[model samples]
Target chain A: MPHTVNCQIDHLSVNIQPGATILEAARSIHIQIPTLCYHSDLCVAGNCRLCMVEQVGADRLLPACATPVTEGMEILTNSQKVRHARKVMLELLMSEHRSDCTHCYKNGRCELQNLASEYLVQDGRFIDLVPFKNYTIDDLSPSIIKDDAKCIRCQRCVRTCAEIQAVSALAVAHKGAEMKISTFFDLPMAEVVCTNCGQCVTHCPTGALVEKNYIDAVWQAMDDDARHVVVQTAPAVRIALGEALGLEPGQIVTGKMVAALRRLGFDSVLDTDFSADLTIIEEGHELLQRLREVIRDKNPQVKLPMTTSCSPGWIKFLEHLYPDLLPHLSTAKSPQQMFGALAKTYYARRIGMDAKNMVSVSVMPCTAKKFEAARPEMCASGFRDVDYVLTTRELAMMIRQAGIDFLSLPDDEFDSIMGQSSGAGVIFGATGGVMEAALRTVYEVVTGREVPFDGLNIVPVRGLEQVKEAALTISSPLPEWGFLDGVTLKTCVVHGLAGAREVMKKVADGSCDYHFIEIMACPGGCLGGGGQPMPVSDHVREMRARAIYRDDAGKAIRKSHENPDVVKLYEDFLKEPLGHLSHQLLHTHYVARKRY
Target chain B: MNGLRELVSALAQKHGTRRESLLPILQGIQAHEHYLSDDAMVEVARALDLSTAQVYGTATFYSFLVTRPQGRHVIRLCRTITCVMHGKNQLLKELETLLKVRVGETTADGLFTLLETNCLGQCHQGPAILIDDEPYTRLTPERIRVIVAEYQQKAALESENSGLINS
Candidate 1:
């Protein structure tokens, strides 16, 4: 009957909203309730049990996070008992967690580390209490490392993996102290349909889930006199690399990033955007050919619903979850791979260097690209196309290790030949971006004229919505194209494998009728990748997404097809789209894996 | 279906198959089958993966898996919980008497899996178990047996044939 509930904050009476937690009510009046497990973006699981407060007439102190505040309830947040309980909770958590924070990957930035310092937990009572036998290692995956020894069992990683990313790759298996977060059936991470998006790593309170560091390999490459090390930075990497340099989260550091790479011993600082534009040129041609085949005979042999093959995580998902739809995926390798291939071939010829002497490195915001680099199918360049794959964080660490003053370094341009790219190429950092980019080029080729859409935003193919759809009307000069012929190019965009699963269901049931689809393994595109930043939220996603579009808008070239470097690349090296050279280097096939 | 004697009789009526062929049959059903959607015996009978009699034989064999369409609410009480507490004997006695069924038997109304498990891996919460797939901590015999009975009564209302039981 009463919506307003009276609750006391430190024995002071305050009316609060019904169904509000004690922490929520306390925070309204600036009463700080310290929390470790409570991430604003995620639902409260009350696992850490650190947010405890004493309620009058209650036998035991209540967990403020789990407890709902009631009317006329007196609460004591800083009582002796409450302090003791929170301290004990922290002690227990610290005991189970690895205390060697100095050497830990999450040393300075870990939430648990911050909590321990804030709570003044000098040492744990059970400091030497070894975690149970389940503190084993599972790092078969190229991108992820799972060392349960450091895990706090906060379930933040599990919740983020399931709720935010919607991959649901990790779950608490077994139970109690022996329980550990794991992929389905305790299978190796590489064996599962885990898109190496790294959301789990971002959400993890400790160093349990982490991106596999390839900085060592990059260092080795730099040390080798015979090796010509080339580095390509992903668009999203430029926007988020600032955070690693102690700059603001959304700060654009493209110039400093280039200078940092030059300092880090990269022979050339290339842009993945250049390769992204190339992907558009080649993939755009592939789409036209496929469309011609579809129109010529409408043969089922032709993969009608062509899915973008840019994200390795999505490629793996296609391999595992939608094996039947493998035909639908584009044969073109991702921009990272494409860049590596061109550096070995086109760049090698221009510089009069041997391809084997060149080591192409990619600094990406994605962990899946690590897996993609290791893939047997990715050696299209006669060597590993991209030899070393480092995340934005890893590159930042390397930059710091190399004593590069990242923040102070003036902005610099990427190397000529492969540095020039369009806004369409830069937008590949966001979800539905690849689809939007592909449509921009494909629509023109299909109609023999530029399609309408100011700045080519393609409003329907933009946003945080998991699945986005758009229809394009084809017209003019291309013989097959007529005024409307009712030829609406049906397109769908899916981010996250869980969303991919729903679309997959439609394809499996023969109900999905989209002509083209774009799938990103990470939610919010590569911007929310596991390797981008720690504790990624809607704020980070928005910041990074806005920064990516901003980078796109600031670009001199805005359309992928119109990139002069790409045009020259086609004429000088590629010969043409779907050409002998392009096919040999860029295209790949997928296989159906048997789950045992 | 209520007693071991009646269960034996039902097995006799259902058996055209031999016992030796059961494991593969059960494994096939678990694998090829999406969930335990078919009658355990019928699924056993259809295992081209195995012979019908062989499947029936396996269906009756494994204590870990179910052979019958289980209750809508399947109570997977951890025997490991009680055993670790050294109260398993007492817990089993209480559960059998309360549910009016043996440890391995489903009630006349199928609603629970009252079987003994080696370990659900929850040693800290000794005498712990799961009810309808949700973990219950610090389970006592009196509380657990009652929980099982409530679950069985709930499971009986839903047609066991159409529902899919994971455990």
Candidate 2:
């Protein structure tokens, strides 16, 4: 059934879809309405009166952004009266806002900049500069740069941080025009538990929030001859790195990227996918052991629900939002951590080199990895395993600085032992890839049969949806295995901190009970990480997501339990999943932070 | 002895509920508790399928909510950029003199606990102070004593009434 929404605009007929908003309809028909305190992604705050439009026979003009298109609604978007009101609103906002965009990082890309250009406001008629009496610029957080001078109080970054990523890292502290964003305390960003996911940066229309790029740090590492620098690339980095090279979003440049890294003086170029497979090996066994405990004991006291701990952003969210469920999180170090720990220990030792001589660097699509590397417990090899973390964009900058042609480089291969990876490892770049990878192994281990689905593509858990859930039944007859039939395996996957928060609330409240859950702190998984290329688009997310799938399809081994190298690591070195060595190296605990 | 809770309870009783309802009747107990404790929140939840967890979740999630009991004199300092630019440091120095405690520490008298908040949403106030739930704009060290005295006087008056009611 097609529902027509009639928006009567000065006696002219306008038709819209059932759920289309008046602001959206006005936009489609090229209606010019001024808005100062309204953003498309943010919730309708209705604080600024910029987008106020006059409705026929009404005493007051309604906010176009907040007002939905209703039948028989007559709106005058561009009347002289509306324009006057909008101009006054903009003038008032300008009086309060710091007009320093010329030297600001968000100079050309600012929404306020575009609006000022459209409004053609030469000067502020009002001088209502509210001076803040007390405050300091908190530069504690490692990955985000916050400048409150240019804040418009739109609350877009706050909402993006809280609602989109479920971090609640930023919030409106005071009331009225005096309202400003803040963390737990007036602590520096570095001191706070911000995952630095950069979703806030992407959502922020101004330069108030930006990434803390480590391009200079990487350059220093490369320049040092005594430091044997090794760089490993995450799967999602290749797809979005081109954006930093002035290529269109979603342009694939894997070959060019490797060549560029080589030119940048990395002694050994490795792949993070290799360690991703290593994670699968350890994590997959952990899941199998948990399943065995469930089957053998038949006790509800057993921790049935084991959540995936691949994403540091998700891990921090759980700590803050749902601290009680910390034990449920798999104690496996993330693939990046595993790679770093091994690069300093196993790789360095195998190559007959000292750990101090090797400078391990990771090119990731995640900002959380930066914070993760800094954790006091992550120094597994008695040193900061990863010395420096570079975003995909930062790597592109390095390539550009090297004067290397990024678009025409030859394809290259990673180094021998740590370079080998499987399709399961590559899929870890996407949201549900971790869940699917774990399932391929656990399903086979428990049932002792091949995965019924071809390609092991668990369709139910796939895609860029905010939350994905699926329930599967463990097949019949394992009397020798002491397992029961028709055991429903309920699993839920949440991507984006906001969506993860929603599911977390249910879990925290003991509602929507599920046996397993997967959470990624960034939207669209690692492909949309804070470390990904700037000015991320839907096209880039799609391309990177596709690249992950392609990498998965190209590999011969698609299951973590099937990786012979991983099997050998456990057999020879680690001994078992919950072994003393595995726990020592791979697992760690979390402490509940006091917000007060 | 302190009379803040008793005063609030008497105020609530005068309005139409028991003194126990003062936490809810006053500016929600969240302002005093950091987050509403299970016992306190359950009392609020009894009226509404709202389990203890639901109430706890809301109380814990929001920054404004105080789930734990706060000190007698709660000083919420705005440490965000707006306040910083407005000489918040001077105000903090004054607060330290008045309370004899640093930010994030409670006074020896147990009368005040100084806390630095992200933003008070009072950016227009520049440096602002929230003494309990009431916000004072454009604050300075000189103005702290007067604000404290005003609240203290009211608390004293309320305590006299609480004694009469109990008697």
Q: Would you list the clashing residue pairs of candidate 1?
A: A197-A530, A198-A530, B17-B53, B18-B53, B22-B58, B47-B50, B81-B127
lDDT of 2 by residue, A343-366 (tens): 887778777889899899999887
Using lDDT as the measure, which candidate wins?
Answer: 1
Error of 1 at A585 (Å): 0.7
**Model 1, residue B71: what's the lDDT?**
44
Model 2 chain A is weakest, by summed lDDT over 10 consecutive residues, at A130-139
Q: After superposition, how far is residue B58 of candidate 2 from its true place, in Å?
A: 14
Q: Please give the fraction of native interface contacts (Cα pairs under 8 Å between A and B) kept by each candidate.
A: 0.00, 0.00
User: Could you give candidate 1's per-residue lDDT for residues A1-596 as a string of tens digits?
Assistant: 79789988897887888999998899888998888788876898987888988988888878888889887899999988888888888889888777888998888888888888887986737755664454678888899998888888888877876676555567675555566676654567776657677878877878888888988888999999998998899978988988877876777788888888898889988899999988988887787788768876676689777878998888876776567878888999899998887888888888888999999899999888998888887887777788889999999899889987777898888999899989999899899788888888888766666668887677788888888989887755466544335577899998877688788778778897888888887888888787887767777788888888888778877789899989988888787899999989888888886321
Candidate 2 lDDT over residue span B1-167, tens digit each: 13345443444455545334433533455444443554554454333312233344345545556655656767889999889999899988888887778887877755577898879899987799887677888887778777766766876788899999999
TM-score of 1: 0.78
